[model samples]
Target: MGAATFNRRSFLKGALMAGAGVASGAMLSGCAPQSASDAAGSGSDGAAPMTADAYEKLTWSFEVPPEPVDESQITQTIADDFIVIGSGVSGLVAAASILGHGGSCTLFSAGTKAVSRGGSNHAVGTKTQKRLGLDYTPDTVAAHFNNEIARQGYRMDSRKWWKWINQSGEAMDWITDIMDKAGYTTTLELPFKDPNGTFSIPGGAHNFYGPEIQNSANDGEPLLTATLEQYILDNGGSITYNTKAEYLIRENDNTGRVSAVVATNADGDYVKYEGAKGIIMATGDFSGNPDMMAKYCSAFADYVADGAGDYDAEFQFGGLMPGDGQKMGLWVGAAWQNTTPSAPMIGWYGFPAPCSDQNHPGILLNVEGERFINEDTSSVYAGYAVSGQTEKKVFAVWDSDFAYRFDTWEALGNNMDNLGITPVTADEKAAEFEAGVEEKTYVKGETIDEVLQALAEQGGIDVEAAKATIIRYNDDVAAGNDTQYHKCKEYLIPIEKGPFYGQYNQLGPAQFLCVLGGLRTSPDCEVLDEANKPIEGLYNVGSMMGDTFGTFYNFRVPGQNLGMTCITFPYVLGKQLTGN
Candidate 1:
């Protein structure tokens, strides 16, 4: 029993993430506590004693459940009230919650130290939101929720989304209470206004700050997982690092509770850890497993970036997502979600565009200088549109007058329409475009012709078509009408002025960041079987849980998965399990 090798014996898992940034949270590999190392990691001798398999007909492995290691291979048994199969955001939070409630938790992770990717943690009504003066009413949030699901074809279950909606604020507040005392700060991510004005949400999702939070300009290490990990270890909860949970041990076959878990330690020793109360699967996405990728997200399998091939042996942490938990769950009567063709957290980074990568309201073209897409969509849709283009590339064209076309500019996670957010000034937007020029990503031109030539130098564009396209665009703009895609007339700023600017950006299916949804989990975080009954003592949080989202993961809600799946469900699970 080691790393949930569901990638091999690791069978089908189906969690699909929506946001584009993914934390390749492969914990420190081969690192364990002193006691574990001394006791062959995770305890001293004995396999878990539980009932037989109830679902004998259920296929156990995609390859092999590795023929459960010999009983003698289990050198020890570690008994605890709760055993968590990962040390990521969900696992750490679950353990910390249990510990906070005065319960014992034994956590096992396949990597070193606790880790997470990205920072935005979206929550609705919370103390932090109140503190930020952006308190959104439940009705407003409900309206927003309805809009979101409608866009996803309403495939999402109201129960799942409501769990997050009603409880996510409390969830964020719970973690915020911890972080507040830990000398941390919070803020709003610059919000990108959807160009179509079709949707909007509160932008002040919790953004953790402080000296301990290592935040770079692009991605942030919120130190959340580390914080939760520390809390668990300090509060007397047990954790064995570098141990990968092999598979689950159920009682009465699959009819009874999940009694225990057997994992393989760094030293390659199998240790049976029994959770008297329950066992939790906090493993992340299956983006790292090729077989799972092919099975769950077959359409985008080839575009899952490059690190997947060496996911287990040479994990590219923060990039690779091995689907051991979901796969492992499948072997134990747990069923994958009913959502066919899962959604991925993908984005198109618009560097030279001098605007939100998500919301683009300008003319866009391909390398061949052909106008593509309506260009009046949110960044996520724009990214999706570009992903299907030739060589997965797009060029954004605008003039120096771009700043004046709109009253405000789209920023990172901050919402200007919101009370607490700082509005982007015209000067700031102009300065950004200038900065792009200095970087050479945005070319400056005295005339449209010069701008087109400069753009050609950056990435070859069909100037003839591009020139003709611009003429038609200007004509349409003058008529205040879009003849092609019929984009929003308000944003159709004619690209006629001198000192025009253009951005050459590349985006393909390769921009996959996270894959959302997996197991059929209840609102309480319990994993359910194909029969729709809760698999007793078996629970899941984070990307391991399914039916939480609908379509393309967007920063629209910022950290939806982290806030809902990773934080909210674990809060409910730990409290319900321990009555804390």
Candidate 2:
């Protein structure tokens, strides 16, 4: 129930005592009745000796099938130097690192392929940043990161944070080299700036653009993963799909050292995989587990509860990842960290066009047609504010000048190929909006009053209330100030232009991009046990890892949660394993 307190000194003490007991041919501490057989190895499976009752008492959300799975009934499929569970970004990177270092590895995934999950990966001092003339040092970013963590009510071990911050650029380089070999182009997602010259967040949003840079859905992630997957296979590494890790096998009498992993394949046949080096847990967040959400993340629990009347299908931002890895870690006496629910990177749905553009000053109204938050904030703040609102839905009302007011990703900067966004002019955007209206995808009209009526008809917004709200907003704009929300005066543009547009940014309950934190891991990504000691051969990465973050997800550094940690740490972990 409390945090584990074991450190290096205590762990060394325990190890010395166990070694002394073995040398003296005496009973080990806590092992009852002191038998010679027990002295040799406590349990039948040679694991940390535990009573049946003790094993049953392990706190976890999922049912742990009795451990020491009958090896005779099951099969020993493959043995390697390393075993990686979950084929997401972390697992693939780890496996690749091992194989690249001339080590043998076997990777298992519940899914068929590595997912193209996060929007961007964060890295400081990246080659892309240099080429794009965006100068951000690691120390500066780390300071911002530390401030963000403290501001959010979660404390981070600065040492561990520094480990990630320092190695992030190198991690990006490692991945980019792989992408380059695979003929995939990596691009940077630019940052936003306010009218008064304050930038949104330091930009490190690296995206894979493949051979072509287009607005299509395939934003280079498929190519990236495909390359990594192929490299792992071509390097004579074993990758098992549709295989679920069941339990971790500990070394001779549960010595706080993991030796092998037991898993079950799709055919219900069990397979035991022993890794000489380590076992890495990459199975992503437990957002799909309702009980886990209720126990650990109250914000998500409340959001799910609030959405009962609206819809039944819970929206999972990055597919269904049921926290298989977290459950496994918990069963093994691993301490949890970052258990607080960070705000989800909520997306505004139902409208094909993008809302929350900083340059495009718009009115954001809640279900009651009342302005809730300053729409002039960064996209992250806007999304977070909307996610916490009643019904998690809001309206973005703008005039025909919307696109013209917000054109170009120049603030963010160009990509690797010297490509900058060609601005979609207001007329072009207006035409597209009209087309969406005709296709019944949006509501638009020639006048503000007509748009308000259409919005009420289409999205059940309070028609009269919306009109009054817009009138008040326009009057505030005319007065050269926003008294209600105090948005930037520069963004206090009136919404009285003809061809007014109103679209519902209706979102469901907080759909998390990925839940971060599970088994508490050290800087090296080693999974820590009950005593704050690293489980000898067990490591954690990606969202399955903990300690890199505090309470809230830092929207201040847009993609750092994924970029700096999820993508970077695993690569660093891999190199650390290889002693590189």
Clashes of 1: 42
Q: Please provide, for model 2 over 19-53, each residue's C-alpha lDDT reduced to its tens digit, 9 standing for 90 to 100.
A: 23321112223442323233444434333343444
* Candidate 1, lDDT over the whole model: 0.69
Candidate 2, residue 579: Cα displacement in angstroms equals 1.9
lDDT per residue as tens, model 1, 161-239? 7777887777778898887677665555654444467634456466765553233212333456667777888899888
- Candidate 1 segments exceeding 4 Å error: 1-63, 190-196, 211-221, 252-255, 309-319, 351-357, 403-410, 413-440, 444-446, 450-460
Record all residue pairs in model 2 with backbone atoms less than 3 Å apart, i.e. clashing. Answer: 6-531, 46-253, 47-253, 47-254, 48-253, 48-254, 121-563, 122-563, 190-412, 191-412
lDDT of each: 0.69, 0.64
